[model samples]
Target: MDEKLSKLVQDRVGGAQPVCLFAYDLDRLTEHVRTVVASLPPRCRMFYAMKANSGERLLRALAPLVAGFEVASGGELAKARAVGGQIPVIFGGPAKTPAEIEQALRQDVTRLHAESVLELHRISEVATRLGRIAEVLLRVNLAGPFPTATLAMAGRPTQFGIAEELLPEAVDTARRLPGIRLAGFHLHSLSNNLSAPAHLELLDFYRRTVRQWEREFRLEVEVLNAGGGIGVNYADLDEQFDWAHFARGLPAVVDAFPEHCREIDFECGRYLVADCGRYVVEVLDIKRNHGVDFVLVRGGTHHFRLPVSWQHSHPFTVVPVEDWPSSAPRPELRDAAVTVVGELCTPKDVLAREAPVSRVRAGDVLVFSHAGAYGWEISHHDFLSHPHPEHVYYGDSA
Candidate 1:
């Protein structure tokens, strides 16, 4: 941990009310976003997926750095517009109501990704009613031995996008629609893809597929929305997605697709924000259950649910506390296997299971890193009506 973060954790640990905290390093997040933007090829555009961490501070900080924002719902679209005003916005989701479509058009979203053939017609009908031409990308669910991902959205039977076999008809429908313009294809089928080679290969597959489609349909492809699934290594902190390697290989990939003059867009969500946030929870009690050590904290899966969902021991660092309030003998576990759990009533509230911890006691803080994305937003905050964690932003007033 850096000096600033250490100080912040210490201050929180010693505060009046011992509360769970979600602290974001805005400086680190800004640098990371700028680094990603700087490394990408000129033909490649980066859009921050608003589903990751929609905190106002985060969104405002990133609005100026990224090319645009990709939103999945009307709420996200409004948030994007409010924070990223004038910056291009792409609306995408598996299920979009006609009202949402109309609102997106009214909000002047740059484009929309059509998930189904019926959705294409809906968008056309809505746009026609609004007397506007809606720019759309046909989201394709490719059939393949797809790349390895923590969550595979495509390469199987899923309701995410139009099936590969049915895309031809979808394209025909798009071309025939009065108020819709088939801009290109959206091929975002995976989540948490850790391999850079696999990602590049997937891009290659998309480019080839787009070329074949353009040839068959005799259509002009403008934008190829390569939906974001870049993975982060939460288990192995040292190992991560090789952004430098991916950037170095991107130019060659763009060069390979000379025939398709489509603008490539990456709507990355988790990869962009995960590393910037930390979930800090106070150790409330230390006990042993059947020869196994357990450290119960004030917060649990209700506050930070990524570890539970992934079933991986979330990497954490112990923030030692000097002052112990209780006069009783405070149990301390040293270099022992401990399962960190929350104050929830359910047994599924385990965050890190049987993980090695060095000298953890009550009042110590367990700082779970890589929690900026899908941390608070995805969690069931009102599960037991537990008090919400305090959201702290560094390098900016919040």
Candidate 2:
């Protein structure tokens, strides 16, 4: 366990009481943001993807550091505005209600990504009603030899963006629309991509495609939103994305399209905030099921769903407890392979499965790191009416 995390668990957990806790080290988050921001090339613009972790405390911490926020819905846009007043916001999603479009237009978002021809028409309609010139970006679904990713949105018939073949029609329609000003293209295809070289290659492809489109269509592109897909190494910490190398290599990629003269936007989510948060849950029971050791905690998938989603053992460290007050005989596990499960009734509530731990007993805290992003918000919080975890923010007060 990290020394700071160990101390935090010790300080936060009470004797023999099973409580779920999420502690975020804001100082670490700020430093991570600074490192990423400083490493980027002059042409690269960073935007925090609000969908990953929309916690107000996290948003407040990131407000001053990021170029702006990339939101998917009206609520996220409102949240971004609430935390980062007047800061630029870009909206993108497959489904957008008329009301949402109206709100986005009223809010004067930096750019709105048109996922489909209908969405482009809707934006034009809404903007025309408001008598406002709406800056728009066509989200392109590339046809390829796609990069390897945990989730691939492009290079397939996904309900995400308009296909590359259909982009010409969309662009022509956009040019015809009186209320719409076509800015550029948004090519966000992958999710959780770990390789920096792969990302660089993707950017190079994006630049070439953008330049080709600009030339073929005789259009001026002001921005090329290369959509954020940077991955966090959850399985192995050492094999993390080489950000320093990526930063160093970005200039070459940017310089390749000198004729394009477009601002490259990175709307990163998980990579920015994952390291700064810890999910600390106290073990309620230690048992053996069919010769397999099971360490049951007070919380489960409802509180943190990433492990369940990935179906992999979440990386965690045991915070040993000195005192054990249970009158019942507690099962002892030492250097054992155990599956960490939550209080949920279903078997799918496992957090970490068949992992070797030094020692874990009742009242011991299992601290799961790299949970700052997609930890709380993506969870099914209201399920079974179980008590919620305490969201603790460390560092400066929010």
Candidate 3:
């Protein structure tokens, strides 16, 4: 523990008993999100990827910040709609069931990104049957070396969308289909780092492809959908995301295509809300065994998922209550290197390994920072009958 964190433990948790709790810094988190969004070019729109953390309160707080949402299922779309009316929403993913399509169409969403030819046909048929025209974006495949190794779908040999060579045929099919409108193009390649030149190159490729499509088909693209793999703070907190460079480079690419004045659409999930929330769990038991200290927390992967989802090794600064000793406990206090494990029955439920902290007791609190995005919402389940984690907003109410 550093000097500042040691004082924090003494101040916040000094005399109060420690129990499991989660909190969000809405103002700071939203400020950070605003800073990131501000760096984009004018007329560039961002759709908050809803899979990151769909807590109703969190969604409500973030709704006004972004242009719209990018949802994967009808359930997520419903959640978005529940937050308000006429929220611009788009549904992605492959092979959505008939009910999901109907729900999305009924919600009057902005667009749907079709991942397969069958899905395109299905949307056309359903929209026609319902006396409506569904605007769609055909997701394209960009085969290359992806940026992050942690992305599951990056290098996998799977068919999620149209191949690069087959896109023209698919566009022709869309042109022939009556009830479906080909609104734009979509590409969600697995690249995390937003390298200046490489990112520019990717944008140039899309712009060139869109231009070629316009020349070949004599149709205009309303949106150029460049999908999201923008990495958030996964490894280190000091690493700053280069938003200004991305903003500056993107306009340069779009400026090349003067006739293509379409909106630059971004579907970013993790970058929006990952750092706004923290996970706090109570230490259930503390023991010294085999020359090591073990601090078992009350929650595990069933609730706090990122510590396991990303194979994450970062431990948050644990602070005791205000009155707790800021200095080291008396030498009589058996201080040792502690490993924080969760209460789950499996051995894989470890949270942090070899965490260095003050001598922890059975009821101390452990706060996991940078847990707001893809932490609880994406990978959590009701396994072992544990209750779902609660979410709260801090700006207006708190």
Candidate 4:
């Protein structure tokens, strides 16, 4: 932990109740985003996926830095509008309701990713009813025998995108449908992808596939939505997806791309904000059970679910607290491989398993790194009626 975060842990944790806190350094976030945006090739745009972390403050901080935000639901759209009402937004989701479609059309989003034939029709109907022409990208689930990621959203059997074989029908229908324009195709193939070469290969695949479609259907495509599947490595923080290398390789890909395609949209979620925030919790107790060392903390999957959700032990560092009360015995472990757990009743409430540590004691604080995205946002905060962790935002977007 840095000096400021260390001080924050000291101030927040030590209370009677076990302290669980989420602190965000927005200055760090802003700088990281600026670097990412600057690295992109010309005509390529990044849309921050707000489903990752939609703290109004984060959205406001990112509004100027990013080209736009990509929202998945009407509620997210409303949140985006609330933060940056006039900023451009591309709306996407596998399942969208008619009311949501109507809401999107009324708001005049920049683009919509149609997941199925019926979704295209729904958008057209809604747009026609509202007297608006909707620009759409058909989300394709490519029939790929290609490389995959931790979570494959496409290029396989998934409910995420339109099947490869069903494209012709979808394309014909989109062209025929009133108040709808088939701008291009959306291929968000996978999630948490860690390889830059594989990513470039994927982009090449997209370009080739789009070219083939253009030739076959006699349609001009203005946009090619690669979607966002770039990943962040949690297990080994030192080794990360090489964005610099990936950015350097993009120009060649763009030069080779169809000249008519004007924009390449990367609506990334996890990779953007994962490292900007940290989760801090105080050790409530240390115990030994069934020949296993258990270190229980105030926070659990209820607060940050990324670990159990991915079934990986999240990386953390111990911050020792000096002021242990004299009344109780200080339970401590040395050179221990301990399983960190939370206050939840279920056995599944684990954060780290058999994680080796030099020394940790009851009252010490553990700070989980790279928790900015998909931490609290995806957690079941209401489960077991535990009090929510305090959110502390700093560094300019606060």
Measured by TM-score, how close is model 3 to the native structure?
0.86
Cα lDDT listed for each candidate: 0.90, 0.89, 0.72, 0.91
Q: Judging by lDDT against the true structure, name the best candidate.
A: 4
Q: Candidates sorted by lDDT, descending order? A: 4, 1, 2, 3
lDDT tens digits, residues 296-369, model 2?
A: 99889999999998777899988778776657776679999999999988999999988999888888888898
From the highest TM-score down, the ranking of the candidates is 4, 1, 2, 3
What is the TM-score of each predicted model, taking all chains together? 0.97, 0.97, 0.86, 0.98
Q: Looking at candidate 3, what is the lDDT of residue 89?
A: 93
RMSD of 3: 4.1
Off by over 4 Å in 4: none
What are the RMSD figures for all models against the true structure?
1.3, 1.4, 4.1, 1.0
Give lDDT tens digits, candidate 4, residues 1-398: 77777777777655667779998888889899999999998879999999999988899899999999999999999999998668999999999999998888788789899999999989988999899999999999998866768898876688988999999999999999999999999999888989998999999989998999999999989999998999999989999999998999999998898778889989988998999899999998999999999999998999999999999999999988888875899999999999999999999999999999999999889999999999999999999999999988876556
Model 3 Cα lDDT, one tens digit per residue, 1-398: 33433344344453444455457767766787788778787768888889887878877777888888899998899899999887899899877987888788888988898887778888888898888899999887756554543462433566667876677788888878878998888877763553555566767777887787778878888788888777665566777456677777877777776555568888887777777777777665676678766777777777787777677665676644333353545221234566778777887777777766755665466778777777777555677876555454555423
- How many steric clashes does model 2 contain? 0
- Candidate 3 clashes: the total is 11
How many Å off is the CA of 41 in candidate 3?
Answer: 1.5
Span of ten consecutive residues with least summed lDDT in model 3: 324-333
